[model samples]
Target: MNTRVVEIRNPATGAVTGTCQGPTPAGSCPYAGRDGVVPCAGRLVGPAEGDPRCWPVWVPPGCRQCRITFNDQAVACLRAAERYRDQWDAGLHRERERVRALAARKDPRFRGMSDRQLQVTALWRWRLSGPAQGLRHAEQKQRDWGRMYLALAEQQRAATPPVVVGGAA
Candidate 1:
């Protein structure tokens, strides 16, 4: 396919910023047009969901009909979930260590601390449960995405038949 060049201009002042050549010229770095192509008015330019740069491309009518593009939002969500899971796991580990340390203390006074101290110590031991639960929830969501990915892959495979390499036996 021939790559078409499009001129990107500043909307406010109408000054040309750069030129891009592609089917859908979006998110490309701005460069001065050497071919002297005029900029088209009302061309769409913006990052799709998760992209950082403002891609200069137009979305065809009905976004649902467009091919599946790598969504940054979905990736960001997954990363956030992973961070939450990691944070929860760390908290759980720290809580376990604290419990162990408290259990190993030799001082009798420390062992027979006041009710408030005992409650505070027990609170840390119990606090880990919340993070563990949060991690489970995050992991479940990750698994759900994995299942969805697999299902989509299976559907795609089913839609496309394998080509036979040799004559039928």
Candidate 2:
């Protein structure tokens, strides 16, 4: 079966950056151009000039107006968020499994326990803390990083020339 593909390019260097599957030509897919199939036979070309899709994925380094950039500080914050979120999810999953296993045992102590009781037991044993605490910590770190990014963006915007009200007083 024919598959559609979208070729992304870096406008500055005219180099292909990446390609993603586009809609098939059957008119069922949105990304499919006027052509019926998702044009994947050959290398999909980048969008023509003025096409909205030609925009860069990330602002270049040293660009002041960009709210988000691939700077080291921003990248490190993102990595930390991912790591913390993953750890929290894994802990929750392990707690759930432990509760399930405990419930399945025919031991008298667990035999008459309700679902809540089993869950509480698993949580205590796993030392799983409240989600609110974790979320708050992550949010604080994100806010700190966001402030730095915003400051840079504001500085860039201020450096740009302002528009004249009516062609020079």
Candidate 3:
């Protein structure tokens, strides 16, 4: 989120007399603000003071960098979803559990419950409610968008090698 307005300077004085009225962030876009913008020069948070970000940027996309951030976040979300899916799948062996829990139902603790109720007790309760379904949909969309961003960046980078002028990248 470290951002600055693209600067428009005087030709002779080299002084920042005015700011660009164009896009707020001169991103990795080659034509944004006609500044041949690249990624930010400053290191984003999390690394040491000197290192550039190795991970993608994680923010909403108004700027290209923001897209990268969201892409990274999307990938992260997919990984997390996979882990959760694994955990949820662990509870699905219900028939095996019912056979096993049948013996325990004879104990005094099962005094109030019938065999059916005892068998129905879930070891790993997994339910995809409406909100959970919506989240899954959103996550899939984000992951797809993230992949698209990466593909686009790779294509553009191959087609055009960036040139550095006198200003910041």
Candidate 4:
């Protein structure tokens, strides 16, 4: 879940920036604990000491050079969460519109049919007469459609209101 990545910079001016995920070597620097220890000569100077933005002269042993900062990872996660939220909202809106449209218009051919039943019927009809590659293809589609239609019909019957008989004298 850590989204940190190492950044590469221009050794001359430090103005140029790039990124890399290479692993840092596990060895001590010869200049460790020496007063002469400093940022790489090519690295930029005059920046605040211990500034996270400033690239280090050398990374410590057993460390990764390509790690991203905690702040950077949090920002990235926020952006991604916002994007997913937007997508989910858009999909929900579209689905709502679809259901509304389906409810608003009633196809005479599919009167009393549920949305899925109507869709199956419509698709079957379209495929039955539309540019099918062969008669067998059309037949197969028709059979599938028939099975679906029958299943829907059975469900509808099961859910139908029972008719009442006349009262006896």
The most accurate candidate by TM-score is 1
Q: Write the per-residue lDDT of candidate 1 for residues 1-169, one digit (tens) a residue.
A: 1244445444344344554452333422233134422233233322223132323333222222111222323454567667777777677667655655665675463475665675567556655576667676887687566556545534433433222234232
Report lDDT per candidate.
0.46, 0.49, 0.40, 0.39
Question: Which pairs clash in model 2?
Answer: 4-22, 4-38, 24-38, 25-36, 25-37, 25-38
Q: How would you order the candidates by lDDT, starting with the best? A: 2, 1, 3, 4
Instruction: Provide the RMSD of all predictions against the true structure, rounded to 1 decimal.
Output: 13.9, 13.8, 10.6, 28.1
Q: Comparing candidate 1 with candidate 3, which one achieves the higher TM-score?
A: 1
Screening candidate 4 with a backbone cut-off below 3 angstroms (N, C-alpha, C), the clashing residue pairs are 4-68, 5-67, 5-68, 6-66, 8-18
For each candidate, what TM-score against the reference? 0.38, 0.37, 0.32, 0.30
The model with the greater TM-score, 1 or 4, is: 1
Error of 2 at 118 (Å): 3.5
Q: For model 2, give the 10-residue run with minimal summed lDDT.
A: 61-70
At residue 101, give the lDDT of candidate 3: 66
Tell me the spans in candidate 3 whose CA falls farther than 4 Å from its real position. Answer: 1-126, 161-169
lDDT: worst 10-residue window of model 4: 38-47
Give per-residue CA lDDT, model 4, range 1-169, as digits (tens): 2223444344334442544332224322222235433222233221223244323333223332222132233444445545544554454455445544665586455467776765565445433542422434544454555555445434433433322233222
